[model samples]
Target: MKTHKEYLDLMLDGLENTKDKTPNSFSYDVLSAAGILFVEFARRFEELARKFDVDNLEGFELEKRVFQITGLKRKQATYARGLIKITGTVGTVIDEGKIFQTELGEEFRTLERAVIGDKGEIDVKVEALRIGPFGDVDKNTIKISKDYIKGIESVTNPADFTNGYGQESDDDLRERYYSYLQDPPKAGNPAHYRLWAEEVDGVGYAKVYRTWKGPSTVKVVIIDIERKGASSDLVEKVRKHIMEEAPIHWENLTVVSAKEKPIDVAGKIEVRNGYSKSEVIENIKEKITAYLAEVAFKKSYVSFAKVAHAILESEGLVDFDDLRINGTYDNIDLADEEVAVLGQVKLD
Candidate 1:
């Protein structure tokens, strides 16, 4: 681990006892150049050592290779799917592959062809043209048709979109990799079922209940990447993956979305001098949401102290009084099949 300067100094000191102990000499410049090469070699050696350790590996491709030896792959991103209502003249043909978009230009395509009915409107299924959470739009947000149709008047989504998720992060993938090594899945055990459920894309966490109904019956409840309850489609995806991987006798396995436990926060707050009350409240909500996501499925109850800490961690907050979670200064217990989600932040 010797630095370039240190290596050069060593060479210079060794020459001090010899005949070539002079500054700006041929031998001195040669040794200095060699010192630089030595430093680079040392750096490369250190990086190589780190790559051999699973914990220190960097880059998506390198991490994938390390985990692939054990049959684990990074979960890919998922596309968002939803329904859009198209209104136009009756008998207007909406062909398959028609594109609709949001104000932000996120595109979605019709999955099937349909004609406007007698009511001059029809609901058609659509999938996001691209993967990731950007595809999940709010109700009535999709108003643009990429290609104008002759009789098309308007388009809108009646409900909020769901089930969109980004590709897994390196930290999250590493955690799962560690979980696989620490509690190796084996022989239809609870750990086995938990890992199986989590392997599906968009599933953030899974809780396994062994023998929930009777012997040989298991139930798995899962949440999505945002720490909210999994959509029914995501639940079915997990169910299908587990069934395909489980042994033939594992027909009693069940997969369901976790019930959402909304955590409503109401309090009085003193905002910092340069910050607006609305800004402070929004910051508090962000911190609280991150806290809830960090503890989902990992803790049995939401800590009252942790909730208060989240508020204190807000960037624009000066002080607070009478902070309440779910209208009480106490920890809220979560059921085994429940995941905590941010509800309302009512601040004065």
Candidate 2:
């Protein structure tokens, strides 16, 4: 906690107090520059201390070395999905890579060219080349981008696009690296399956259930990196990735998304002096969120003890009372294939 100014003052004081020496403004000027330089050096040294771990590493070092060693890298922009309905002649052909645009000018292309069927349904889906949430078109938002199509009926999203995200965060990479260490490399193991499932671009976390249905049946339940339920597209991507990377002989692998079960938290808290109620509440919520994220697939119960610890350890919170999260003194027990998501935070 000592500042460079304090260090400089000590040196200056020692020189001035010596009977044989005189320390004046002239000496102060020279010491001040050195003090500031030392301060910067100390600041950089502190930063260097944090760069050793994957959790605190940043920039090229993290992306190039740390993440690369873990066999993971930052995720880039992803395509969005749109359902299209075509009403044309029975033999009409919709070429692959046909570009379509939303009413708002967001463009997407068909994955494969297809001929019009009796029902006039185009089974293959389209994807937006541009990544992120910008490609997430609302239902009925897309109509026609090019003039190649015959008759346009409707275009919409069957389900919400949850995987369209920006570049991966340091926290995400850190978690993946830790997971890689925890799971390690093993063949035909549940942890291995889970690890492989999470390797897909948008996958957040994956849980492996051995013998989910019967003998030789495995189910990999996955969630997106944003902690939301995975989309069908992402599920297929995981399925394919797992099939190619780690295949189990004589075992049936099923890739599915985790079901989100929201556990709304309502509580009251008391903060220490100089802390506002809103700030303390937000801090508590963040702690709870982090705790939930870490223990998401590992445990089914949301421990009230851990919740209390998060609140008590939160900055500016001295004490708390009537802290009833989900109205229970007991932990919230979740069913299989269910992940807890934060819903409401009510505090007094």
Candidate 3:
């Protein structure tokens, strides 16, 4: 029979080194930590029940023992229900009407610029602070990347503080996949969605959901995690993970890693490639265009691969806000499947 702490320790200890990889790239990133916790917990439970010859016990007795080992409430499953929510919206630079006067008399103005970023881009930082504000309501837990966001000293909106920052909407990408799943890609189905998932943490968290949004490729992920017990270091770990993975998010987006904070996050890495490396550049651009064309997304990376692909496919001519597509690391290479995926990129 193992103690709850022992189980947690065993689970977290088994995780491989995921340090150098992008956010959640390794199996034990934050999103996947829940699964790791579940397996060890169940094993310890069975062991304890059999050791005490309490297998026959049912109802409250069994329940009590289980809780004794896991510290998880019965409703914990449901409690985790919206553990994360990426909206189809984005945070805008907010002016908090603040000014800092240095001892030398230089006035530095400030605003409520929200910390915004997504997976892999989590470590990206701006000349902005990522700390969120306390919501109007109490008990609201909002997590933000520790970058490019400011004005934590004063705030009125709980969302910027409680809800978190980054592209809004997890289902925005799922909606696109559901579209194709609901309606099979028939002939001339100009825009189609491809998807994949893994059984992590006992739930099918979406690792990759690509779609044809407006004019850029957008990606959302539940970063894999390997967590043990609840420790104050947990927050710092999350912050470090985000900062380390920012560069892989985009080609040219500037991701400056900062101090450890809440959920690690970086800026909407703006990737800009030219016709010189157009082959590789165009590869990224095409997938991004297809993805952006289909989803009503939110972002300002209009200067991203979407517009770039449009220029290449059009013989070096690009139109402002031209219809485009999207892609990711998985299918970036030229492959048989890429035919269907790449075809999505066209003059729109």
lDDT of each: 0.89, 0.74, 0.30
Candidate 2 wrong stretches, greater than 4 Å: 1-46, 88-99, 103-106, 110-125, 137-139, 144-167, 211-217, 262-295, 298-332, 340-348
Residue range 144-263, candidate 3, lDDT tens digits:
322233423222112211122222123332343344446554321222211211111211122223332433333333221111111122233332443343222442222111111111
Clashes of 3: 49
lDDT of 2 at 245: 78
Decoy 2 TM-score against native: 0.62
Model 1 steric clash pairs: none
Which regions of candidate 1 deviate over 4 angstroms?
9-17, 25-27, 102-106, 117-121, 138-146, 248-251
How well does each candidate superpose onto the true structure, as a TM-score? 0.89, 0.62, 0.17
Two-way lDDT contest, 1 vs 3, winner: 1
State the displacement of the C-alpha of residue 300, model 2, in Å, after optimal TM-score superposition: 2.4
Error of 1 at 232 (Å): 0.3
Model 2 lDDT per residue over 35-153, tens place: 88888888888887877766666767787765557767776557666566555567777788888776778787888878878886655577887887677666666677465666655
Off by over 4 Å in 3: 1-164, 167-205, 208-308, 312-331, 334-348
TM-score (C-alpha, index-matched) for candidate 1: 0.89
Better of 2 and 3 by lDDT: 2
